[model samples]
Target: HRFGITFHRNKRSKAAINTELETIPGIGEKTVIELLRHFRSVSKVKKASETALSEVIGPAKAKIIIKHYQQTTNEN
Candidate 1:
């Protein structure tokens, strides 16, 4: 607190959420932001179809994301 930085509860929550998304393979900050903006939540992003994700983040990135989720789902 000595640095005079104000603690924003909302930002802390957002950071935590972003961190969770980043755990998914091939998802970086920009990709996470795009997912958040498009799908609005981790579950939605996970549930998104390859085509839907491609619509938001492009085909290459979408394939990576879709594959990661598909692998995760298959493992469970």
Candidate 2:
């Protein structure tokens, strides 16, 4: 006799995953999606210059994002 087993995986929104962007105070789902789309990854987003980030997310949010990363780096 032979037996087969199957496993099911749960589908989750890309923004709902364990994302550092979500941890930032002013960032939300829409912004996370936009950042991921433009920069392709969180690491790229973290490293992007204020001018580059502003191009994608505007000046206000770019500043918030940069500051968040800077503080996180210093804490580490």
TM-score per candidate, chains pooled: 0.71, 0.79
- What local lDDT score does residue 37 receive in model 1, on the 0 to 100 scale? 82
Instruction: List clashing residue pairs in candidate 2.
Output: none
* Candidate 2 colliding pairs, count: 0
- lDDT leader: 2
Against the true structure, candidate 1 has what lDDT? 0.79
Checking candidate 1 for backbone clashes, the offending pairs are none
Note the Cα lDDT for every prediction shown.
0.79, 0.85
Q: Tens-digit lDDT track for model 2 on 1-76? A: 1222222222344346868898899988889889999999999998899999999989999999999988989999
Best by TM-score: 2
* lDDT for position 22 in model 2: 87
Runs in model 2 lying further than 4 Å from the true structure: 1-12
